[model samples]
Target: MKKLLIASALLAASSIQQAHAWGQTGHRITGAIAEQYLSEEAKAAIAALLPNESLAEASTYADEMRSNPEEFWQKEAGPYHYVTVPKGETYKEHKHAPEQGDAYTALKKFSKIVKDDTAPLSERQRALRFIVHIIGDLHQPLHAGDGTDKGGNDFKLEFFWEKSNLHRVWDSGLLDRRQLSYTEWTEWLSEKITPEQAAKWNTTDPLIYITESATIRDTIYPEGDRLGWDYLYQHLPTAKVRLQEGGVRIAAHLNELFAK
Candidate 1:
């Protein structure tokens, strides 16, 4: 029992250290919103795979697994959370080794697993969780990083008088500042998502999502190191929209994958 407690504490510490994308609350918000938009067919399929788990419950699985001591989780999966596209270059123009996977490649790989009927149930479940998580990650503009700065993780700054990096600020600082539960965020964002907005955002193209994020990322770096209410006031709306889009796109991708 003591060993188990120690292991749990280690995992918690690892999660905190490796957090590079939307934090738990942000990911859960996207998953909850995705659940609201799922088609009946998609809903049934997801229910079969996940059983008792809702998308919101499954959303953080990929990030949580980062603490696993396995090589795949420790190494290979590290690059799956974000993509690096250099300034003035599109993802298409940026070449990377096939083995050195990025978010774009990882998304395609897991997406295929999720849609493959013959894949093992556990594999499919993991793929589903990754899909939920990665979509949320892609929406966090910093995750669509420039070639430098490690997705803004290296771009250190002070946020609300606290020492934080640009990536961390986008990941949790802005959203957490609101102090809303994931459910409340879901409800708040859902009310603002019109049918037309949903229709437009329900795009399954990962390239579009990545490009949109990169475009936002390029513009978000503050002129100076210190960021307070003004920075939050300027960027929070964009962050909310990205979360909304991530949720809508997750449902769209699942609906297409499970379509009869």
Candidate 2:
């Protein structure tokens, strides 16, 4: 029993350490799709800022730095990955403190940094990478949590006969099960986005992203603790839609930022 308890504690710690929106592949997919929509000027500006790194390569930078020993990574930036708007409440009703910024606030903060010509190159690069990442993070429904279950991380379940949590299943399990590389997923989804859909989805408004995800979040909790094919069949379309929207919106934001 002692050994079992030790394993459980280790698992919990690992889960907390690893918590992030949309596993690496999902973030990369959004980044790749966003690249297809960038205006020439936007592309040039991004290339200048990121040099050799494509947006897809930069999209996971923030998450990849979570293990950094800096205070910003270890403590200050933790809440920026998600927001909490309890069921039936809007973000305005539960705005997070500025000192403890959430995704909405962080996006705005990073956007300014990315757009500032006087900002140090290193700072702007970091901000731009984070902007690419946090936009992807905000699209994951669980990231706009309903102020319960720690954005579904606390809601344990079995996914494909393996132990998992709601957040993890949504983060990677559903997308990973399809076994497609991020490029393939980006290609498949980008080809399907209609001009009308792109126009509609291309909004820099973070609130809309958060609200839409929160609304979706309320509907995604399964009726049981076990999830499999049926759940995927029902929710996969929604996940794809979110990824498409995230990519389109990321492009829109970057375009506007660099339009100067």
Candidate 3:
């Protein structure tokens, strides 16, 4: 029965092909974004790890990061880790089988691997870089969703004239239609952030981010079958809020990690 639901969900998600790309595109954006924000430690780590490679080579790696990040993880998987319950009880949590491994254990092991001097510089940089991006991804609601639908991937819906799913709406649907580049979006978002919000955003517990994303899952879907600019006008504020929060949280976590 569980397998049937997941299969059905994946089938549903496949019907609207564009939504599936978020997991990939997010990482691509993530890797590209890293070049813009790397700290000296991160830079040194990259330099040492890929001593002979040019920055452009490392930058281009984002292309493949979108293709299949798991391959890159092979050489550099340790630092940014995940945990999945290794057991038959995968039926737990709505049968959300651990896609990676035990997330808690993965986190601990990754933290250790990245901190240890023994880890390769390139590998360390990769792990750190991935952590920077993935943590933000995890906060994006759809990413933390059920395994079957591929995190809202299965739930077919429409936004305005285009047929889309909940995941795609959050991924870029809402943001893209605004006609703002990521940087422009970031800047616009940055401007509205109050000191109060920044202070609150700085605190711990990514679970809040995860929960925030999940809460928004249904909202991303239009009220009825078809939605249009009215929906966008109504929801654009929320979209801005999420994007702003993402940038703030991204910077917050990186600052905490790299703090001397």
Distance (Å) between predicted and true CA of 154, model 2? Answer: 0.5
Error of 1 at 141 (Å): 0.5
Model 1 — which ten-residue stretch has the worst lDDT?
A: 12-21
Worst 10 residues of 2 by lDDT: 10-19
Error of 1 at 99 (Å): 2.3
Assess the local accuracy of residue 106 in candidate 3 as a C-alpha lDDT between 0 and 100.
44
lDDT of 3 by residue, 100-168 (tens): 443233433445566678878666665554455545455555655544565565677787678877677
Error of 1 at 132 (Å): 0.8
Q: For candidate 1, give the lDDT of residue 56.
A: 92
Query: What is residue 40's positional error in candidate 2, in angstroms?
Result: 1.2
Best by lDDT: 2
Candidate 3 versus truth, CA RMSD in Å, comes to 7.1
Q: Top model by TM-score, which number?
A: 2
Using Cα atoms with residue i matched to residue i, what is each candidate's TM-score against the true structure? 0.92, 0.94, 0.66
Give candidate 1 misplaced runs (Cα > 4 Å). 1-17
Look at candidate 2 and tell me the lDDT of residue 8: 100
- The residue pairs found clashing in candidate 2 are none
